[model samples]
Each structure stands twice: as C-alpha cells, then as structure tokens.
Target: MLNRVIEQFRLKVSSIDEVEDSHSSTVYKCNLSNGENVFLKIPFTKLKYQRELEAYEILKGSVPIPEMIDYWSGDEECPGAFLLSELKGNSLSTKAKPTIAFQVGVLQAKMHSIRPPAEKALSGIKNEFPNWSHFVEEQFYSFAEDVRDILDEHLYNKAIETFKRMKQELPSAVGPSFVHMDFRPANIIVDEEKVSGVIDFESVRFGSTEIDFTKLYRDFLSYDDSLYIAYQEGYNSIRPLIDLENVLPFYRFTDAFNSIGWCKRRGIENNALFLKENVVRLKKWLL
Candidate 1:
C-alpha cells in the first residue's frame, strides 16, 4: 500500500518516516529517491480529509501555505490522503518573539481580506452568516453543550447569560470574512523572523474576524499583554482595528469552555485541569 502511494507520485521512496501522529490524522515525511521530501496527511475521517483538500485548492497561490502535490480520496479498501510540498521551517512557537506574534497577526489580516467562494465555501463550526452576534450566540450554545457536565451548573448558566448580554451590545452588522477559525502558533510556519507559511486548513472558513482574533487573544497574546499590543499594531496596519474589548469576553468564554470539553474527551488530565483553572479568568471578564 505504501509503495502504491509512492508510485502514484512517480517517485521511488527511499524512506518514509512518521512525523506527527494525532488523534484525527497521521503525517509522514516521505523522502524520495531524488532526496526531495514531501509531507503526506492521512486523516481518519473523510470530511476532514476533503476539507483540507478543498482548502488547499482554494488558497493555493493566494495564502502562504504548503503547495499540494497530489491527493487520493480513499475507497472502502484504502484511506484517503493528500501529499504536500514540505514547508521549509519550524512552527512559530520555536522563537516566540513578540515580532513573530505580530507577523502572525499580519498573516491573519491578509486571510481575512480574501473573499471566499459563494457556493461550497467553508462555513463556521455551527454555520456561517453575516451577522456576528448570531454567530456568537450559536457558539455560546454549542460550547454550553460541550462543557455542561464538567462545569458547575450555576457558573455555567451565568456564563450563558453574560454571552446573551454581550450579543445584544455588539454591532448590528459585521462583514463575513475569511478566518482561519483555528489560528494558533502551532499552525503558523516561520523561518527566523519571516512567516514562511500557515498550515492545518481543516478549520478554514468564513466568519466574523473576531472569531480568529479571539482565538489569538485566548491562546497566544494573553500570555504577554505586550504581544497583544504588538499583534494589534501589525493587524491594524493592514485593516481597521476591531473593538476587541466588546467582543473578547464573549469569545473567551466559549473558547475556554470548548477547551475543557476537548481535553476531557481526549482524557488529558493536565490539560483539562489547566483549562479548568481558567474558568476564573472567564468569570472575572464577565461578572
């Protein structure tokens, strides 16, 4: 089976080493007879496989992502997979400089400016829409479902009510823009101070820019307020600045709650505990 995949690419495989093994997918670094290497991603589910494939096609030449080499949609006998030209750098987290974080924000701004296709465009986790408040409401409910069992009933209800209030206060209309939806340092590829590419497009979609911004804030920028400021400086240089204060708390609650559920489902005790500890941070922003 492995030989067949290599043959399809018209290359004799010298060596194939497994690189990243995760719950949903496995990646391999395939060394060719010519010493060139490519990355293969084999996803456990078809939807995820197709999503990544389509994302690569849509963003090709437009976004700074790895180039797709070839793809095979699996049948009953074989699993689906895609091959990509291996990006030439480590993840952005390797350096963790404020300037790199700022560049990450700059890349995100470029993605947000791109107009997604009208039909067959990827939607948000719930569904994409023009109204940002409705999107926030959907995320609030979806997140509530994920973490209800693990959270204190009273605190959980309070969080929902807080989201409802914030929803009302948000601007009536927000343009539906392309957002990575899962933007994080791990998904950003960098060479020294330059952003070489961004990766992991399975969660790519069109939605409120705030969705991407919120993930950035909760995951990366919060660690250093200066990074947050630096990020905004880069982002606002390209596009109009968002009122993150008005939107941050609402998304923060949903993201933190969703993380708890993800950690619990994966049974990662330390991560779950770490996420649970942030519930206080959520409440402080709300109440």
Candidate 2:
C-alpha cells in the first residue's frame, strides 16, 4: 500500500518511517530525496479523509497547519491518503508549561474566530448543524446507543435524564464558528517552548466556540491554576473569553460519556482503562 501511495504521488524518498501516535490513521514520515520531509497519512475512513482535507482547505492561511502537498482519493478497495508538508516541531507535552499553554490558547482563539466563506457554508465543507445544543444532543443519543449494553440500566437512564436537563439549561448556539473538536496537547506542536502548529483535524466541525474548550480544559488547563490563567490571558488578547462556569459541567460530562462509546467502538480490551475512567466519571456526576 505504501509503495502504491508512493507510486501514485510520484514521491522520491530517502527514507520512510512510521509514526506511532495516531489512533485512527497509518502515518509515515517520508524524508524526500531533496532533503525535505513530509507526512504521509492514510486515514481509516473516507469520512475522516474528507474532514481533514476540508479542514486544511479552510484553515490554509488562517492557522499554522501543515501545507497539503498532495492527495489521493481512494476507491472502495483502498482508503485515501494525504501528503502534507512537515511542520517542524514535536507534539506538545501533556505537562506543558504555562508559556506553551498560553500560545495554544491564542491559536485556539484564532481558530474559533474563523468564519467559512459564505458560499461554502451551505456546500457542507464543515459538519454544520442547526445549533450547538442540537449537535450535542445528536451526539449524545448516538453514543448512548453504542454504550447501552455496556452501561448499567439505572446509570444509562440517569444519563439520559441528565442530558435532557443539560440541553434545557445550557446555552444553545454561541457561534457557528470553526472548532477543532479533538484539540489536545498531543495534537498541538511546540518548538522552543512555543506552540508552532496544530494537527489532526479529522474531527473539525462548525459549532459553538465553547465546544472547543472542553477537551483542552479537561486534559491541560485543569491541572494548574496558573496555566488556566495564562491560557485565558492569551485567548482574551484575541477575543473575549466565554464564561465557562455554567457550562463546563455539561460539556465535561458529555465528553466523558462520548469517550465510553468511542472505546466500545474501537475495542474494549485495548481501551479498558479509558472506558473504566469515563465510567467512573459518569458515576461521579450522575450516580
């Protein structure tokens, strides 16, 4: 397959090495014959490929993402692939310092502020929904079905009730702006203690700016007060930061809930700890 991709793209490579961090794609670092480096990514699904391609197109000049050098829209027999210019940096460490966190916040704010071209709005380059609450509700119901057998009856019922209340109480649509749904330290690139780039846009969508903050807060900002403060400072420099006090619980709960379903779909044994953690989180909130 790699040889086929190389032949299809007509790439001249000095060496090719696989990258291990991806969960849903086969990624390789290809050192070009011309002493340049590029990433070769073949996503597991056509949907993933489409989303990433559209995201790169939308974010080309606005965000510090890798350049889309070449692509192949695969047929039924093979999933598609992308050859992207290498962004020269390492993935941001989970335990990133306040300075790096601040830069990430700035970049995220920039992403949230982007509005797609008026024509493309209806063309469906992004995963657009009626509103933020509607998107969340749709996801909750879909994920609930996936985890119905895995979650105890009482817990599942409570979760359904909680989601209903959350839908009623939380704000509906803050902005139908660009959102990187899978924003996290692992997806961010850093160099010399500064955030240089962001990657893995297969989950990109058009939704509330608030939706983008949940994963980052859960994984990074919540760890330290100073980090949160610095992040907010950077975000506010670009635009006013949303008040998360009232909505954090709802978003965080749903994030954990969705993760359980993701684990079930991907494989329970391989993600047992992840599944158990999310279950514990749900119990802490609902039970």
Candidate 3:
C-alpha cells in the first residue's frame, strides 16, 4: 500500500538512507534517481498526517520549517499521511556545545516571539497547550501500566512518585506561545554550525515557554551538563529565563511517560537503555 502511494507520486527514490527514528516516525534520506534529494519521513500509526500538514502550513514562513512541496494522504488506505519536507542541512544538535546550544536557545526565543495566530488562522490544527495539566494527568494511566517494564526500580518509583506529587501540587501556568513541541536537536538542521531550519512540528503546541526552553537540556545537554551550562549562558544572553521550577516537572513527566509508551509498543530493550539514561537525568533535575 505504501509502495502504491509512492508510485502515485512517481518519485525517483534512489538510495533510501535511514536518517532517524522516533516514537512517531522514521526518516530516510531519499536521494532521488533524478538527482534531487528529499527527506522521506514515514509517519507511524500514532502520527496524524493532517496534524503535521496543518502545523507545517501555518508555520511555513513564520518559522524556518521546510516548505511542503507536495504530499499524499487520504482514506483508510493512506490513513491521513504525508511526506513533504527535509531540511537540507546538518542537524544543529548533531554537535552539542555552548555555541550550538546557545544559538538554539536564541532561535527558540525568536520562535516564541511570533505573534499568536488568529484563531481562524489555525482552527485546523489542535492548539490546546493551555491544557497541559490535563495532558499530563492522562499519563497516570500509562504510567501505572508501564512500571514493570522499567529497569531501575528505584528510579522508576521516583518517576511515578514525582509525577503523582507534582500532579497534586498543580501550580498555575504561563505562556501558550506558538511552540514546536519536539523542539530538540535532531529536528533542527544546521549549516556552518548555524541553525538552518526547524523540523518535526508534529508535537507543535501552545504551552509553557518552559516546554520549549527545557529542550535545550533534553536535546543536547541531558548527556552533556557542561554544554547545558553553556546553553544556559547562551539562552540567558538572549532573554530572561522563565521560572521553570513548576513547569519542568510536568514537561519531564510527559517525556518519561511518552518514553514508557514507546517501550510498551516497540521492544523494551533499547527503550530500557534510554529509560535508564533519561531517568537518571530526570532524577538529577528533581533531586
């Protein structure tokens, strides 16, 4: 079926090179037989093509997202999917540093500054980041089911317990600015070490600036604390840091819970490795 759709586009797929894979999609570098290169991202079952296409359309010129050239999606046969963009540059996050980190920080700040779209302008995409608390609350169900899959019993408990305590606290929230929900290093393509384009607006939501800001840590700095510090310095250079004390926990909850779900569906081996790593980072932040 996917092959049939590809044939409809008559795309000259050359060397189909694997680029990256996440919970929702897998990307390949499609060097076309016609000599042009296109990034082919096959959306997973969990992903909605309409959501991606809508988000990309709204963010087209507003952000440095890859412009959609064309897409194929419809009916149960296609299950509402698309393939339209690949930023032709290095993922800015492939190299982590004060420079790249700080630059990413500044670029994110610029993204946040774009004026909110008129409601009619974005009614097609679900713009409900204001309800992040509700979104986090839903994770509790997934969390309860995923405990046994977790390797480090101590850290696993820490994650569940922290999420519960944080939910109970329920602090007031902040800005619901235009956000690239998966605002991490892999989605950001770079040229000459400069951020060139933003990719994967699928997780796009209007939520706490903390959601976008903390990614500087998640994307590049989680494993690189020194770079995190540098990123902080760079981020601080551009704008005042929003008080993330309350929001980051929720952000971390969503991230960890999302991880568990991924493991549940995809084999737990690699997911366990990632869980061990990210759980440690989450614990460091909480501790």
Candidate 4:
C-alpha cells in the first residue's frame, strides 16, 4: 500500500531518510530525484493514518500546511494512508534562537480565519460544527472513562468537580473558527524571521480562537512572562484577539483538562500532575 501510494505522485525517491518520531507516527524525509523533498508519515494505526491524510487535504491553501502529494488505503480508496508533503523549513522547536513564538502568534491568527469545510468535505477533521457546552460535557465524560487508567480515583474526581464548577455561564460564540487545537511552536516552522510552514493538523478542529491563542502561554510561555508578553504584542500587532480576563483563562482551563487525557493515553504521568496543579490555578480565574 505504501509503495502504491507513492506511485501516485511524481516523486523520484533515491534515498528515504527518517526525520522525526512520536508515539503515533514515524516520519521519513524522502529525497526525490526531481529535487522536490517530501515528508512520508506512516502511523501506527490505520485510524490515525487515515486521519492524517484527511487533515492534510482539508487544510491546504488555508495555512502554510503542506499539500498532500499522495494517499493510499488498504480497503478504502486510500488505504494504510501514506502522506507526502513538500519538505518545508525547520520546525519551530529546532530553530528558536531568534524567537519563533512571535511568528507562531501571527500564523495561528491567520489559521483562525479559515472557515470549516462543508459537511461533505469534512472527511478527516472531526466535529465540524460545535456546541461549546456540549464539547465541555463530552470532555468531562472522556476523562471519566479514562480516569482509572490516567490517575488515581481521588485526583480524577477532583478534576471532575473542578470542571463541573467552571463549566457554567459559558460564553457565547464569536463565530466558529478553524483552529488547530495543538498550535504550539513545535507544530510551526520558521525561515529566518518569518514562518514558512505550519505542520501537524491531526488535532485540527473548528472552535473559538481561544483554542489557538492558548497555545502561546500553555506550551512555551508557561514559565516565561516576558515571552508571553512579547508573543501577545507580536500577534495583536497583526490582528487583535487579546482579552486578559476571559479568553486567556478559557484557554488555560481547556488545556489543563485536556492534558490529563492526553497524558493518560501516552502514559505520561508528569502531565497528570501538571493538569492537577493547573486545576488549582484555574480556580482563581473562574468568576
């Protein structure tokens, strides 16, 4: 299936180079004979493998996300999906010396401008249309199912109680935006001082701009107030979406709750502790 999909694209591959690895996928940088480079993602599961292909297709032209060169499936039209994307610049994580967080702010603001695809085109992205309260409720239940697996009984129940308290008086929508749920520095790429590419859309969903904005403080700026201030200045310089009171806290709580589940799936216990601490921190933010 992998070879068959590569055949769909006009790539000339003489050497396949392994580039990056995560819990989900193993990526290879394929040096083509045509001088065009592509990233080949082979995921561990068919479900995620297919989702990656779907995410790549829907997100094209919306951001600097790479275009899908080819996709293959075993039973479906594209099986065991193999994605080929033009090799873009260095990821933000690998090149943060000159400050990529500012670029991340601007890039994400642009991504927030994209509208969700039509029902038919939402092949890979999950939950195109959203209800904010229901989304929170679902998160509560998802955490419940994974409670025993992720943490002790006491901490899990405490999180549930915290979520229950904070979820009331939900804010009205400011129009749904195309948001990459994990819009962190690592998922963005930089060339010199500008952002050349935006990668990894698997956590892509249609939601409030807060979903994207929170990545600034939650991921890289957690311990650095100066970086957070600089990032906010850079982003709002391009487009305004700052609210120290409401949206900022919203993003924090969202990440705090979601991280617990994310940590459980990967068996990363440190995240569970982090989430519990943030739950305490988020207490003051709630009105």
**The best candidate in terms of TM-score:** 2
CA-only RMSD, every prediction = 3.4, 1.9, 3.5, 4.4
Q: Count the backbone clashes (under 3 Å) in each candidate.
A: 0, 0, 0, 6
lDDT scores for all predictions?
Answer: 0.71, 0.84, 0.64, 0.63
Residue 268, model 2: lDDT of 96
List residue ranges in candidate 4 displaced over 4 A.
1-12, 21-24, 33-36, 43-58, 73-83, 94-99, 118-121, 126-129, 242-245, 250-254, 267-287
TM-score of 4: 0.75
Please report, as a residue range, the 10-residue window in candidate 1 with the lowest summed lDDT. Answer: 121-130
- Estimate candidate 4's RMSD in Å: 4.4
TM-score of each: 0.83, 0.93, 0.80, 0.75
Model 2, range 159-278, lDDT digits (tens) per residue?
Answer: 889988886887656777888888877788888777878998777788788778888888789999889998999898898888887788888999989899989998999899989999
- Candidate 3 per-residue C-alpha lDDT over 1-287 given as tens digits, one digit per residue, 9 for 90 to 100: 54654676678786777665454665566777878877655565434565677677667666677767777665565554455656666866535556777767666776766545675565334555657667556655565566546536776666667777777775665566666767777677777767677777556666656667555556567777666666666667766657656666677665765665556667767677876665666667456
lDDT of 2: 0.84
Candidates ranked by lDDT: 2, 1, 3, 4
Superposed by TM-score, candidate 2 places the C-alpha of residue 22 at a distance from the truth, in angstroms, of 2.1
Model 4: ten consecutive residues of lowest lDDT: 278-287
Give me the runs in candidate 2 sitting further than 4 Å from their true place. 33-35, 121-124, 127-129
- In candidate 4, the residue pairs with backbone N, CA or C atoms under 3 Å apart (3 or more residues apart, or in different chains) clash, namely 12-33, 72-78, 72-79, 73-78, 73-79, 74-79
